[model samples]
Target chain A: MTTTTRGRSDITRLLLTQRIPLLAVLIVVVVVTFFINDAGGYLTASYDFDYMSGSLISAVPLAMLGLAELIVILSGRGGIDLSVGAIVSLSGMIFGFAYGQWGWPLWFAIIATVLFGGLCGAVNGVLVSYIGFPALIATLATFYAFKSIAIVINNQQPISTPPIQELYSLSKSVELPVIGASVPDVPLGIFTFLLPTVVAVWLLLARTAYGRRLYAIGTNDVAARWSGLPVRDTRFKAYVYAGLISGLVAVVTVAQFASARPDAGVSGSGMALPAITIAVLGGVAITGGIGRVAGVVLATLLIVWLNAGILLAFVGNEGSQYQLLALGTVLVFAALLNGLTTRRYGGTV
Target chain B: MTTESLNKNDKTEKNEKSPKRVRVLPAPVTGQEVVLVGVIALLWAGLALSTPAFLTAGSIQPLLVATAPIALIGVGMTIVIITGGIDVSVGGAIMVCSVLTAKTLVGSGVNLGVAVLLSVLTGGVLGLVNGVLIAYGRVHAIIITFGTANLFMFLGLQIFGSGTVNGIPGTLAFFGRGPDGRTLGVPHAFLITVLVTAAAWWYLRHTAGGRHFFAIGGDAQAARLAGVRVQRRVLLAYTTTGLLVGLASCFVIAQGTSTLDQTVGSGKELAVIAAVVIGGTSIMGGRGSVLGTLLGALLVQSVASGVTQLGWRSQLSDLFVGIFIIVAVGADLLRARARRSR
Candidate 1:
């Protein structure tokens, strides 16, 4: 009996210290709770697999931007990019002007928007890595600058020309080719945009020399410098990568809205805040040098499903307000858990 | 020979003591503060030259009233940042306080003192919540505040019920931009801000408790070792910020139309932070001045006013603000480098 109790305690410790397991458990709890509620006729609509799959559309931009934050925050030295939302707003407008009004080829417009986003990120990189500004200050300044430019560039108007409107098909639900009869149809952007980006990011982080350099520098900048790594260059590239991701998210956002609103990325509480929240909730250390792409993806799923359930449980705007409460409560709870885990178990995995 | 040696030793001791005592206090005005004053003056002069109405009483009074809220909140923010913590929830706190206050005023038509007291108390309670979590929980200030910001916003929205609190009485007219809000030639709101800033400046400079904040920010462990009551000091910092946010919300409501909307304090956090940062309050903590924050708020508002007067898009002002932050922080970094080299 004593051995069994000790063994069970050990398993508990593992679940608490390893972020992936903890998040997985929470996701299960959220889904099961909503399912129970739905069965009891508490939900306004069915909390079925189809609804869950449909909700993944929101996860596209959220997960992408969370990954963007993951990259920047992993660069250490108080690294963060508060301007990703601004980049999305600005880059989406560029996409609007190019594809919607200027009548450029879709592929070319996409490339230009991504490049423009990279250029904006490069500005943050130069200020932070080269000129020695704090990542917070550099990005805060850029957040202002990019947001201003996005708003004023087009006289505060959205671009929803015919081509842009036609782009809405990108977000439509599509059945899987081989398993079409068994599973719910997922949003097309999952395959066309989110999946590709996630795979690319995962490959880059897991397989490349640059990825090792980034983690090393983030872990300890002085040690990395002593080891002859290109510390500044690696850090700079992180911001650039984040910008690139934001640019893609902008395209996803524009397509989802079927219009390039100047405030698409920044309306209400703003995209950057939610992205950062997801990153942190995914067990990304705010102090840097610790996080995973898988963690961010799972975090996105958890929030999206949780929010979907919340929407079903309440009426009208009250649902959204309750969503904020849930988000805040969960974040605070997770953060406190992180602190406790660190003290009791020597930090999360 | 023994007498001459003893006299020389006493002279050296006196010289060392005087300089060390002087070093304990920073310069009355730092280099950054001087530069900020100069920049504000130059901008004012330029605006006056470009637009005849820029320096007029009508433009200036409203500008001062607008600056008051940001500057007042910035005073608390300056202290918080000085202690190596930040309170981003002030915007949300402002929303909750203003909405609640506005509701009370609209519902029962309370007197000015009662309304002000209610708002400040509400803010204090919010601040206390932040302080308890941060002080005892041992979490990052930004993370905790970010969470609370969301919670407070939710609370604020719930208070708004049907979207807006319309037909609010002008109970806060004393803090408004109208003639009733002025005492002689100075706006009452601006005067109150100046008075508060002065008091905070004195407290921070002359009191040991104030000096303790800098000690905590510089190194919390070291401060605790030296008997600084680190947790208590940290709690005080955030609570003070809450009270100030409460006061600033009143100023905000006073300056706005009678209707209280959900957007009451949406982005005010960033605006106050910009003012604090521009004022030479280091984001890294341990060094800052409330007086500089006041001036920073003044400068940002002036730029906005100037932009409008020049017929440029109002949004263009944010771009200038971003540039100003870079330039100010860049200059500070350069100064630090020079000092290190020296």
Candidate 2:
């Protein structure tokens, strides 16, 4: 295939692959909505619709987290970020305290939170890149320390988000269309599916010099460093970027849950794996380099869909306990798919 | 390339250099592995003596119990790492196996033999899935195994019906139960661990398949060039580790009730990885030993009991484990550098 065709084909392949996953999730949602409402118009139930909208909204913050780790993995540092969960809890606690008890403005709360996330991520980066600690071990240390720090500050209680009550009341509100009145489709709640940021990340990863640098560094760190790439700086940036994105996740998280739990993302300790699986399934190399943002988005959708579908279909419990099974299956299957792809291509992780 | 061919080429190309006198025989200790292992042992002995309880059997049972699963898991882990792959899903495999035995035997009418066999099967299947992903699916072993860990734990929960299952059939309890009445008066877990370690040592040190793991870990492409069946060895390593973990799970559930919590293996996988690394196994994937892993596990688990028996709270063990892991892993790194330099 010609170069352009290959690029086009890669895009097409990612779309096709992710289409199946997304479709699976969509089908599950549709099926659940249609059938589970055994009660007449249960689909129109206030709580149910609120939950549906709320879930997708909640998913975006996690996707940001998924994206944050995705960028780091794209740099090929072993798809690991042990401090992510802690960072979220820590930074979100800061945001919550500032906005609620401390009375910081909402936008200021976001700015401060994102910066704190970046700072924490930078700390992770320095430890991994400069200090020569293995990504897993260094982050492992930070994981405990960060959470402990947050616990010390928050005293192990969930904190309310300021200005969050507005979003909460809005999320709880059911929009009813009177005979001929049109309601502006659910006033875009704060951080609900921020389209611009996703596009920015996509372009940054796909079309820029820094993006290319990330791919190069990820693909072959030794070669890149030998070739005069700012190895340490690039790495530092990757972790910082992951942290900033995690901060965005923290922000949306506050809005979504309207409460900040210090324990948020404890179960997310192993989350980087699924994120890596999605990135790799979307065609990013685990060793780094040679991937695209489009693929990751697709893979993320696939994972979310498959998981949501499994629950909606009642193939498993529509609860957290069974989510692990669903995620595990997706990851392993994707991994197997990765093996097959590389085997055919004469490559290996 | 054949050694003979390379030797012939080297003679012709380096003929201008000093004549090649009869080569001096290298001492075993001169090898990097021996030197690194020796240094680590020295440091460990020094540390162990500081904690009065670290070396005693009574104080060491907690270590044995904690180390059993990790050591068993590490046995499989060493093979995989030697094959230049890793399986981070032992936690899942162990968790799943622990509960599978419990769920199947407790009030389920299954015989002990069958329940035990099923647990082994559960681990094998989990391993097989991981193996298939690593060997055939072509994903990173670390990642696929990560997912497997999650799936296994989730499956364990689903199959287990949530809360811990208790009152295991008595027959199966021999392996899982304490060594309170054993002839040797040692923790059965410790004995099983030794047996497993010995088996691994024999395999890795004596058997060609074992050598193949090192060959692959050293340089997989070179191993391929040397005509080793890389994929098959990888698969064998994974499956074997899974089997041992199955055994480990039996011991875990045996400790009290056949029932185990889903979190039973939580944080344990990293501990196993740390032990393997501490035991001089390269996380970068080339060298380590069954013996080193045993020592590593002992060192790790002992710290737990040593702290508590010596009167410190048990939570401090995590910090110690982390510190020891850093030191051990760091020592290996320096040793690797020194060896390479020499």
Candidate 3:
């Protein structure tokens, strides 16, 4: 009990110390953007709000990715979802195609996509948990295999459908007062769309006994297993959950855009890897077991802020590949800072 | 590290003996690899038979020229994989080196040798950065290199814009130049690949650090406790990869006299990795050979080359490679499991 309290306080203290720099950066960026773009952009403009909200919405898929990954990482089995992006593309493609071509309902499409993601995730979990394949190689194989499978299924075609305006509005609500009208303030996507997902995820992760064990295993799988936790089941669940959310996110994306492109999330490195970066930058430990939902939220916001800043600043080239470059640079910088602090604390980064 | 040890390992294949015996046994090259090479050779022969143009001494030149960067990269990939590390940033590293070589030609105007040395050094540094993050930061090698890959590619894009370097063309031009159908009808790229292969073979077999790669791959903690400077060796291995990729970048320009776009090497690591595995290097790490990697590269390239000759959709190449990777890994697992049960 003493140890738990001590740890809680320690983390609190660290967060307290770090929060200043984080907020300071946030405020400075806000101020700088406000002044520089002052064609009356705002002491902050509501366009700023929309821009920030857009980043948050963009970050939503990544958050699902990060959370899904965070669970597996916490389970201490040392698993990574290398195929997450492929799965994302595949699930999104399938859901979009079924809804577009077969006229499936939104709920059905959502269920089917999430189920598909779960099945793929289950395959990975089984190979690692049962067949005893190495996590890295196994996931790597699935990563490629899933990609080819998606490509083969769709023949690289985009799954575009007629617009579903009502469904789209679910994720696209905003209340604007507009220079003193009825509404009190500006609105954002998180409040309209992702807040529900966030609340649901928080409840699932924090308010459940399974969540406790999920973290325990992440700290040390062997010990957890020996203590009678269903390491395999829990690990399997982590993948399943990741896949399910990926699927759900895909369906939401399709409905939101009313089109699911084959390249919806087809990057080589995979969204799972970058999501891990976001998670780590958010305060999730790389080695797993310790992290906070709030930290992840803050980190996601930070990423959005950085991206929007780059777009507004127009620093390097116009390609937006530079944004990817900056994103990676920020992640590395965060990691390096982690190493330095850990060393000072006599702790490993 | 030795055939003698290999046979001795096979001798330990008693029913009750640990499956350690199979670890020592020579992994036969796969059909994907063998078939791919056979196809390459057959394509050359068939083309020669079908078209008089194919036999013209200049016909194979393009093929050889194309293989230069791939081969140079194959060598570095062999090292990193042998240590169970994947350096996906090789393409980015090479791109950076390409522009650096070009920049030297343009901005620095250094001699060819110094420019090559400088480019190679830059590669080594990029690799070292990757190694430091992976080994010390405990981040997966893919993510760190992914970050660095982005960093390098962006830097390359910034330093050398999308345009090819004018009439100067930034390519080195000397190392890749060939005599008029001399040197046994092989392109300079082929010759370089062979010489580098020989060097890699000797290095893997002769050096203590070379042996440490396999050990670390086999089991990192065991290697660390075995008094190996595991991190330093990992750093060196990655740096070696960088040097080779850098060499590849230089030769690419030297051969073609053209600059590549930012995405030039973005996803080529997948092919090199697939080639390495098809050639019999375990994706699980700790078990690969220089010769095996060479065979793997040949096999992977054959898939690309042969399909092109056969007029098949090149995009299906991913499917073929993916299927082969799964089969190869599955076979390894089955074999390992069988040996363990015995």
Candidate 4:
């Protein structure tokens, strides 16, 4: 009897403190509901494993940028990067110039683009961490600056050269070689870009001393300074790292689109908001100092699959419109839940 | 009468002897406001010289009309930011208000007053949603507003139904840039914005309730201990922003053509924020003025007009805006540092 009661409490604790488990349950519910709708012939398209797997392509950029925001926000002090979308737009332009306009090798061009994104992020970092600009103002300034440069740099044209067009193969669905028969094929970008980023970010945050320092500063910088941590440098590097990730996302975005569009990142609602939404929904505290890679990854999966289903549920432009509604509702729900969990349990999943 | 004479004598003696102890409100026209005025003057002179048509009524009137919505919203934003919170959903709120009011205008041909009231009420409801969530739920204002921005945008798109709300009536032409929008070469929209801004400036500066917002922003727990209703004040700030947003939407609808599209208020939140920050309002809260916000909006619109008139790429104005933000905020930071050291 005691074991059963203890087990029940353990389950409750897991559901509350661990965002991963809760996200997993939500993902299951979403998938099951979509399946029910599919069975009832209510969907415009089939809601199956193949369609779900195909949709993970969008998660590549979402999760990568989510990680970028996660690191910056983890450094605390009203930390946020409003310029990620702008960085992507600017860096993709540079990538376009290097790979499309110039006759540069693909690997070198990729490195240059990623480094350019890091430079953009570094600018934001120096302004925010060293020069004492507020993060919102600093990033907002750069968001405008980069967005303008991206448009002006190329005279506002997309580069769809031969080599850039070939990059589309990177985002195409690929069948797994060894375990390929039963399961569906997944987008190659998931393996080449997304997995590598997820692993690298996970190892960095989970294993590195810098990550610990970042969290310490985020939780309370004055205390961290008193304890002799290099608070400013740590926070500065977090922005740089976020930029570096944005640089990588630029490459993924370019490959996915099969062309480097000048407004790839800042065209509509912009990529930063969705990335921030993902990070928050993954249970990262907007006030800072608490988040995890697994949580962000799972949250990305949940949103991607849920969006995929929503699209299937509705038709044409209506599908896209409802996607906005779903994203908003889920984000608001998660935020309120974060508040409730923090108040009631003294911690959040 | 003798006690009053005695109190006046005491005040005069205190003012004379303990000058440092005597409280003095800051000057109405601050250094930043003066600098902004000078900069705007320089830009206008330069533009007038470089572009022959810049000083014309055709050129200047539209600029004033365009500046109205942003400056009007900046008044409310100045109050919100002064209270140590932000509302990023204004753009989305604008979309909802404009679309609803546009549809109403297209469908019913509602009179000008009723249309204005409808938009403001819509904005108030949206603002109340944000106020309650932030004040009571205790979520960060940016996150809650961002979520609501999407939701509001969704609501707006749903209202649009098809693609755009076409054939909107011109009942709000008084707020537009045409002859109907002006009297004695002053656009009515700009006139309204100026009057509202002046009123807000007085309310924020001279009133006890206005002082309460600054106290709450400086330190909420301390303000609460000091008998301020911190939550209610915060709620009011957002709601007030909403009411202003509603008014601004009517201006937006009037300024546009007969059709309203989905992109009506895109990136406007950032524009309004840039104006607020440039106006020397502290984003960290507890320090700001609506007067500075008006100057900031004017400077921003001036830059946009200058860039276009110079035949430079229209998008390049954003680069200038970005630079101005850095310079403006950087100057504020330096001044703050000097003050702290002193």
Candidate 5:
């Protein structure tokens, strides 16, 4: 090949193999494009550092769920959890009852809610890992069941007692104790919920034997089984972890909304779609066994920033509609890119 | 040339002959189908005995009409799933189709044939988008459909603009529950669904082309080696589903009042999927029937109607739906396990 061809192939190879660099470049491009649009005096709201930092609030739940999905998809065997959003809604309701109605201590209520979420996930794990049900079918059934119970449990009325209403303070933006004045305040949930989950998941995946076993089973369960690995248990734990994270997210959503809405998780296309989209865009192979924590976090940042920019780019309800268009377009683009890369270079991010 | 060698040759030939005979198409009514029919019948009988008004035409007519759209879409979904693909975008596609058809009727006073044709063609176009991306792009069916579902919803909302499509003319009254919609006490929508389902049943069971879908789903590479044209068949399945979705959108419009809202098809995809899975169709693909899909849709609709008539909370009906799905698939799973053990 000529020198030019060699250089061009080198660039293509880097773009296909190293997903983080590609996502970073895309983020920069998006920011620059929005800045240009803002400079042209076309934005409804200012597109600046302050606005972008404030929009990081959405990223907390998104990144948390994205990490949750990363764990399950990493387990392989067509593994997935469609009921994450439903779990969020159901657990949120339980949290509402404990903290708001029953007036339990916040710490106790939080722990109970998380455990309830894990219990729900265990149901899915048992069905999928032990009972031999397809992950998609098992989660889907639970999605429906949980959603219905969430609604009927409270007769579709959202719980917004005095304690729950006070909990809204948890979602407000807060300044860091040091060097915080130099930057915009970040959503408090980022500190309280998202960061802990991210660090825990990263450590669990990176520095643990369980994580190694998960990757082993996801890569090839039969091979792992032949090697005497606890394949089913590992897979089951992945789902339980996903549900546990979703449960934590339930508290975050309740805090944000100041009430526990029964349909909070399942409204519209639901949280599962966006979370899965983030995982895929973060270079998690839909076929399973390959993904990263940093990649998911970066992908969430890119989307949250892009969406915030789009919200500024348009006025009124049009912005939200266009957000759908943007999300759909980006997802399709990423999915197709995943396919192309897998064929061209024999792998994806 | 001894007796033992001759006996071995005879046994080998017998084994080969038996496989060829057994690989012949499965029976028209499977164990799952019989069980589904029995369950539905028992539910209906119980409802009729407890509630004197359950068997009346006023109640039954609406139930059949409600079932028509789901069963119609379920037929196409049956084919798609058999080919190892799914179309979650059907809900969004229905919204686009119905909203467009309703708007056209209200805006231009179009006749029935033109309206139906317009809806179907639009649905075909949308389905074609999903088919091309999934088939040619080589991505998974679920992801592509999920993406398209959002895109189609955006498109539908853009068309819907301000709000509901109010004051739609009854151009589709022929498919409604009114006297004009029926011939011999059968609503036109349900009748049409039945005829189309029957045709699909025959095509899937008896045709070489239809059997290719099963072959492809069983193993795509093997089917390719067998000259199945897997991609084209998969694309055709989605496109066919789109066409059916278009027609079902019309049924949805007819069943409603003079106005159509933006939430027209919000969760219809799940309902159709529930119906298809309940019909004993394997999600892993390669085994299904349109006849069973029809029966499944009927059973689900009956449950919904029964729950309401029994003065239960309307939302509680979904609980039953969830339970039914578990039971239906669980029974099939047990049967497969039993077969494996045997």
Candidate 6:
């Protein structure tokens, strides 16, 4: 009996502190809850595999931006990027002007847009790492600048030229090649954009010296400097990476919407808030130096599925409003849980 | 020789006493405040020169009225930031308060005092929720407020139910931009903001309680060790911001038309934060000034007005705002560096 109780407590401790495992369990719970609700005839539409697969489309941009935030926040020193949504807006417009108007080749347009995004991020990096501005202030300023420029650049009009409109096929659901008959189709952008970015970020963080240096600097700036790590350069590159990711998100957003909108990323509550929310909910410490790509990916899946279910659970605009509630509740609960876990144990793994 | 020696002894004693007092308090007006005043004056003069209508009462009145809400909330934001905490939920809180207050007025036609009281109380409650979570839960203020911001928006939206609160009575016109909102050429909203800023300025400077806020922000652990009620101070900071947000919502409603749309309080959080930071308040906490925030709000509003008057795209004003924030904060950073080196 004593052994059983100790084993139970250990499992509880593991679930509470290990963010990835906790997220996995929560994701399962969310899906199962929705499935139960559907079986009970509460949902307006069937909450089935196809619906879940289709919902992954929205996760493309969200997961990517979450990863972007993951990189910046992991750099520590109150590192945050409020300008990502704005960067998406601005960079998407640039892509529009390049591909839609100038008729640039598809691959070149994407590369240019991503590089431009990195350039924008470099501005933030200069302000924050080199000039010593707080990340929040620097990004807030850039958010304004980028948003304003995006709107003004195109005179507030969206570009949905024939070529740009053709980009919509990129977001369509496609079946797996070898196992197509057995499973539901998944969004093409998931493979083309989200998966590639995720895998790249994971590899970079897990298998590179630079990633190790980033973690070192974020964990303790002065100590990293004392240890002869290139603190400033590593931190600067983190912002640049975030910017590049935002730029890629911009392209995905453009394809999803079938247009390059001036306000693509900033419409309504803006994308930055949700992305940051996802990152935080994924157990990425706001203090930095602790997070995983897998955690963010799982967190996105949880939110996307939860939101999709909510749409079927409620009628009209209420669904979206409830999504806001769910998001806020989850974030608060996660943050509190983080604090509790820290005190009860050491900190989340 | 005896007189000279006596005078020298007195001078040394005075010098020693003055340095201690100076070290205890920051300068009454910081260098940033001086620069801000000069910038505002310069811009005003430039605008007045370029456009004859820019200095007219028609433009200036609305501008001051517009600045009132941001500046008012900024007073509370100043306090919160001083405590090393931020409440991004002010926008959501504004939504809840204004919507609730608007619905009440539309449904029951309450008097001004009642509407103001209801709004303030609602804001106070929301703020208290944030305070409790942040203080007791020991979570970072940003995360908690971000979460609450969503909850508050949901509440605000639910109260709306369908669309905007149309046909809102003109009971709030006393704080509006109309003839009644002004007294002797000064807009009531702007006047109230000035009074609030002054009171806050005094409270933060002359009182030990105010000083405690600085202590907590500077170093919470150290402050607690010194017997300061760190949690209570943090709670008070958020609650005060809520109360102020409540009042500012009134100003917001008064300044707008009768129809209160869903977008009423959306994004006001960023605007309020921009004003506070521009005013020379440190984002890192432990140091800030309400006076700087007031001036910051004034400067931003002036730029907006000038942009519109100059026939520029309305959105261009945001670019200038972005630039101003960079310049203002950049100047502060440079000054801090200079001080450190010295």
For B253-321, candidate 1 gives per-residue lDDT tens digits of 899889988888988888899999989988888889999999999999999989999999999999999
Reference-based lDDT, residue B318, model 5: 77
Query: Which residue runs does candidate 3 get wrong by more than 4 Å?
Result: A1-13, A16-47, A164-173, A176-193, A255-258, A267-272, A315-322, A340-349, B1-71, B102-115, B132-143, B162-183, B218-227, B251-259, B282-285, B307-311
Q: Can you list each candidate's DockQ?
A: 0.73, 0.35, 0.35, 0.74, 0.63, 0.74
Model 4 chain B: worst 10 consecutive residues (lDDT sum) = B1-10
Lowest summed lDDT across 10 adjacent residues in model 3 chain B is found at B1-10
TM-scores of all candidate predictions against the true structure: 0.97, 0.79, 0.80, 0.96, 0.96, 0.97
**Can you give the lDDT of residue B19 in candidate 3?**
58
Which residue runs does candidate 2 get wrong by more than 4 Å?
A1-52, A77-79, A92-112, A131-200, A251-260, A268-270, A315-322, A341-349, B1-58, B108-116, B169-173, B176-183, B306-320, B338-342
Cα TM-score of candidate 2: 0.79
Alpha-carbon deviation at B71 in model 6, angstroms: 0.6
List lDDT for all candidates, in order. 0.91, 0.67, 0.68, 0.91, 0.90, 0.93
- Which segments of model 4 are wrong by more than 4 Å? A1-13, B1-21
lDDT of 5 at B240: 94
Tens digit of per-residue lDDT, candidate 3, span B1-342: 343343354467555456543554344444445654665577668756655576565655655666666766777787788777788777678778877777677765778778878888888888888888878786567657767877887777777765656444433665565563136767666677778978887776656566778777877887877677888888888888888877777776676544444455656676667667766676656877666566656545645555555666555556666666666666678877887899
- Output DockQ, candidate 2: 0.35
Residue range A1-349, candidate 2, lDDT tens digits: 6899999877655534443443355445654544455344332233243334444543465456667766887777564686777788778788888887788887888899989999989988987787666677667656655665665576677887456555455333244457313432232432344454577788888788888888888888899999999988888888999888777666666666778777665543344455555655565556666556655665555555444434544433435666677667666666665555465544432
lDDT of 4 by residue, B23-66 (tens): 33456778899899999999999999999899999999999999
Q: Could you list the iRMS of every candidate? A: 0.6, 3.2, 2.9, 0.7, 0.9, 0.6
Encode model 5's per-residue lDDT on A1-349: one tens digit a residue: 8999999999888887778888988899999999999899899978988898889989988999999999999999888888899999999999999999999999999999999999999998998899888787788788888988999999899999999999988988998888898988888989999999999999999999998998899888899999999999999999999999999999999999999999999998889989998998899887778999988998999999999998988878788888888888888988898888889888875
Error of 3 at A5 (Å): 22
In model 4, how well does chain A match by TM-score? 0.97
User: Which 10 successive residues of model 5 chain A have the least lDDT summed?
Assistant: A132-141
**How far does residue B37 in candidate 3 sit from its true spot (Å)?**
7.5
